[model samples]
Target: GRRALVAGVADDNGFGFAIAKALAAAGASVCVATWPPALNIFLNLIERGKIDDSRRLADGSLMTFERIYPLDATFDTLADAPEEIRTNKRYAERGDFSIEGLATQLVADFGEKPLDIVVHSLANGPEVKKPLLEVSRHGYLAAVSASAYSMVSMVQRLGPLLRPGGSFSSLTYMASERVIPGYGGGMSSAKAALESDTRTLAFEAGRKFGARVNVISAGPYASRAASAIGI
Candidate 1:
C-alpha cells in the first residue's frame, strides 16, 4: 500500500535493487536505504543514467524508486557514536545515515506512519579470506556487527515503524546451515547468528507487534561487496 524500504543497496545489480524494482513494478512505492558513503555515488549513477530502469516487465512497464535514504546501523543514537567513528576517513564523508538517523528522518517525513515492508540486505566480513582461527577480534566483531546484530537492531528500531501484519525479511546464506570451504573469517558464524536471531525475532516480534519476521538464505551471487570478500 505504501512503500518498501530496501536497505543495503550498493548498486543496481545487487539483490536489494532487484527486490526494489520488483516491488515498484507491483505498484508498491519503493524507497532504498544505502550505505552513506556510497549514497552520493548511487545518486550520481541514477542521475547520469548509468542505471537503466527501462527493462520491459512481463506486463510491459518500467519501474523506479520513490526515494532513497542513507542508512548505517552501528549507532542507535548519534550521541552513542565515538568521535573517531564519526570522523573516520570514509564515514566522515557521508552525513548522518545511522539507524537512529534514518528512523528520525522517517518519523519527521512520514509522521509516525508504519511501513509495509522492511528488507535487511546488509553483510560484511573484513577477513573473509582468512580462516576463523586466523580472524582477529576486530574482524570477527565487525562481521557480527554488520551482518548479525544489525538485524536485531533493525527489528528493535523499525518494528514499531511497521504496520500491523507487516513483513520483515533479511538475507542470510546457506553458510549459516552448512560450512562452505573458504567462507571463513567468522562469516559463517555471522550467518549462524543471523539465522538464530531471525527465528528469535520471529517469535518475539510476532508476539509483540503482530508482524512477520523471516530470513531468506540466499545462494552465493557475484556482487561488489561479495567480490571484495573474495566470495
Candidate 2:
C-alpha cells in the first residue's frame, strides 16, 4: 500500500483530519504530524476515543494512522528553532520537530522513498484579529512563514523522500485573491504566496524529484482555522 503523511492535523474539525481519513479510506497507510503544543491534546482525544465516530469510513472501517509525529513547520531544521522553543515543556522531550527533522525521522523509520503522498494542511496567523494595515512586520512575516513558506520548506525537505510521481498538496483560501473582511494578519497575503509558490513548485519538484505539487482553494468552512478569522 502507498504511504502518506498529512501534516498540520491538530484536531478533528479541520481539512487535515478529513484528508487523512480520506487517504486511509482509499487504502493508503496514513501518518500525521501535529504541532508540538497540541500533540498531547490530540493524542489524548484519540486515546479517549473521542473521534472514533468521525474516524469511521463509509464502508464501516475506521481510519488509522500508522504513526504520528510532532512537527512545527515554522523551522526547516532543528538548528533554526529558537532556544525558548527548544526548551519549551511541550517540545523539550519531543525530538526535532522541524520539517527537516520530520524528513529525517521518516527516512529512518521507513527507508528511502517512503512516501507516495505529502499533504500540507496547516496554517497559522497570530495577529489574525488585527487588520492588515495594523499587523506588525513581525506578525506579517510570521503569518507568511508559518502559513506560506512552510510548504516550500516541506517540499524542499520532504520531496526527495517521495516516490517518483508522488503528490504534494496544500490548502489555500479564496481570501488569497478576494477581499474577505476580518481575514487579517497578512493571512491573505500568505495564502496568495502559497498559491503562487505551488505553481512554481509544481514545475521545479516535477523536474527534480518527479513529484507533483498542487494547491486546493477551499470555500468557507467552519473549521477551527476559519473560526480564528471570525467565520
Candidate 3:
C-alpha cells in the first residue's frame, strides 16, 4: 500500500501540502500530521472547500486524505510533555499526540507496518528574529531541538512503522551551509545538524530497517513560519 503520513502541513500553501498532493496524484493514500494549534484551522479550511480546486489530481480528480492526525514533534512521547502543556486547552483533544503517540496510533489503526512514505516537515525557530549573540540559551536550544532533533526523534519512533523499502525524509534549508543574515538564533545550526543526522540515519536505518533516509534542502518559500523570521 502506498500510504504516506506527512508531518508538518500547517497550511495548504506549504511544501508539505505539495508533497501530499503529488503523492495522491501518484495514487498513494495520504494522511497528514499537523501541529495542534494549526490543526483546527487547517481542517476548517478544508471543510469550507477553500482549496478543493487546487487539490485536483492530474487525472481531474480531487486528492483526499485517509485521515489527518494531530502531532507535536517537540515532545517525543506523552510523558516527555510538561504538565502545563499536557492540560492546555489546545492539546486537550489531541490525545497524547507526540511522536511516540503517533507511532502507537498508527499501529492501532493500520497494523505493524503501514507506511510507505514518512515526511518530516517540521521546523520551529522561536527566536528567529533575535540576533545570534543576543539569543537566550533556552531559545537557541529550543530551536535546535524543534527544528533538528525532532526529525531524528521521528525516525527513531517511526522507523518500525515503515515497511521495507520505505522512505523517510525531512525538510532543511540553505542556511545550513551559509550564514544567511536575518536568519539567526540557532536555526542555521539546527539545519546543519539535521543534514548531518540525515546522512547518519541513512546508514543506521537502511542497515537495520531496510528504509532509505534523506533530507530535502529546499530554498525559501512563504510557509507559515516565514513571517516569524522578521526578514
Which residues of candidate 2, in runs, are more than 4 Å off?
A: none
Q: State TM-scores per candidate.
A: 0.92, 0.98, 0.96
For model 1, what is the error of residue 5's alpha carbon versus the real structure, in angstroms, after optimal superposition? 0.6
Clashes of each: 1, 0, 0
Q: What is candidate 2's lDDT per residue for 86-124, written digit by digit as tens?
A: 999999999999999999999999999899999999999
User: How close is each model in CA RMSD to the real structure?
Assistant: 2.0, 0.8, 1.2
- The reply for model 3, stretches above 4 Å from the true place, is none
Least accurate stretch of 10 residues (summed lDDT) in model 2?
221-230
Per-residue lDDT, model 2, residue 161, is 98
Better of 1 and 2 by lDDT: 2
lDDT-better candidate, 2 vs 3: 2
Q: Residue-wise lDDT of candidate 1 within 12-64, one digit each (tens)?
A: 77778778877877888887888877788888887777876533356766556
Give candidate 1's whole-model lDDT. 0.81
| lDDT of candidate 3 over 86-188, digit per residue (tens) | 8988888789789999999999989999898999888888888787888889988999998999988989999989888899999988888997888878898
How many Å off is the CA of 85 in candidate 3? 1.0
Candidate 3 local distance difference test against the native: 0.88
